[model samples]
Target: MQPGEPSARFVDIELEPGDLRLRTLVPADAPLLVEATSAEPGRSLWGPHPLGPHSLRDAQAALAEWDPAAPGQFSLGVLRDGRLLGAVGLIPERPGSIEVAYWLRPEERGKGIASRAVRAATLWARDGLAVPRIWLEIEPGNEPSLRLAERVGYRFEQRVPRHCRAWEHQDADRDTWHDCLIWTFGTGPA
Candidate 1:
């Protein structure tokens, strides 16, 4: 990829997604990271996550010793003029398949940022990584997110029942389940 260009990875598919730049996630983004994590009631809705401030320093410290191209679990920071809008990441399911996920700040909602980010990711998964399918897991109540998956070239392929538990929103033992809407795109950019 050219300078300022995103990689073929799910998080950096766009060769040059103008305005918004996909940059390597650095440890110094701890404060902004803290803000985003604390924006929602739950740090994350997919699984058991901390309910308060995150180990920003520790996470950043760890990133310092890691390599982005090492192998698995790649995460990228979505930035616009150095401001953190959100993040995009890839979670490999197996040898030739992976799941893509992303999150944007509440204030950045309705700005098409998620779709662009997903598009970049989709392109990477399909073209760069040579992956066959890309799945996006969204909460049942997140209508905007659900629509976003479709808008970005993903369609509802299946409804995974009780796929996730929002341990923070609902009681940990309540079995607060969320349906996972599966979306897919072409062999290339979705």
Candidate 2:
């Protein structure tokens, strides 16, 4: 497990508490993914056009891109009683550290699910994967996510100007960039 190496250990594992489990997303979960991402907040966060998979085909195509065994990234679904609520993604950012991002069904927001899921994932990254550092890169205007990061015990580290740039999904004609706030979890070696 060298620094910045993706852990294959995440490929077939499930993090559990019974009430809410984090597991790998399967093709069968595409419909649920579409349902969760088809609404507000998710629509904006995940899209600007096509508005996040209007059909099963679209959702499955998107799901196909998530490779659990890929070199430096993986995504898991947040499930409660077999119902998909949202997803959490982990991407290696730099040596000895990884960045975590999450989103929930629009209707599921503010119920503390995000905090619990994040805590579980970070704990797994530290204890299960031996990752020494975990980070959350959030947009400055996303107040909900900022609060969620704090509730999950991440401390504000700094605000980075124009830390990210990307084309709007499926819309190469439009691209955007924004300032990001970096938050770090207080665990493992610093």
Name the best candidate (by lDDT). Answer: 2
Off by over 4 Å in 2: 1-7, 11-17, 44-50, 166-174, 186-190
- Residue-level lDDT for 150 in candidate 1: 74
- How big is the positional error of residue 158 in model 1, measured in Å on the Cα after superposition? 0.8
lDDT of 2 by residue, 1-190 (tens): 6433444445333445457788767556777777766664434222233554356776676565555655656677888877778878877766568788887887888998888788888877776666888999988988999999889899998899977655455554466778989899845444
State the lDDT of candidate 1 residue by residue for 79-144, as single tens digits. Answer: 776677777766666665667878677778798887887787677667766677677877777898
In model 2, the worst 10-residue window by lDDT is 40-49
Q: What's the C-alpha lDDT at position 4 in model 1?
A: 17
lDDT of each: 0.63, 0.71
- Candidate 1 lDDT for residue 52: 45
| Candidate whose TM-score is highest | 2
For every model shown, the clashing-pair count is 1, 0
Question: What's the C-alpha lDDT at position 104 in model 1?
Answer: 75
Evaluate model 1: give its lDDT.
0.63
Q: Relative to the unseen true structure, what is the C-alpha lDDT of residue 82 in candidate 1, on a scale of 0 to 100?
A: 64
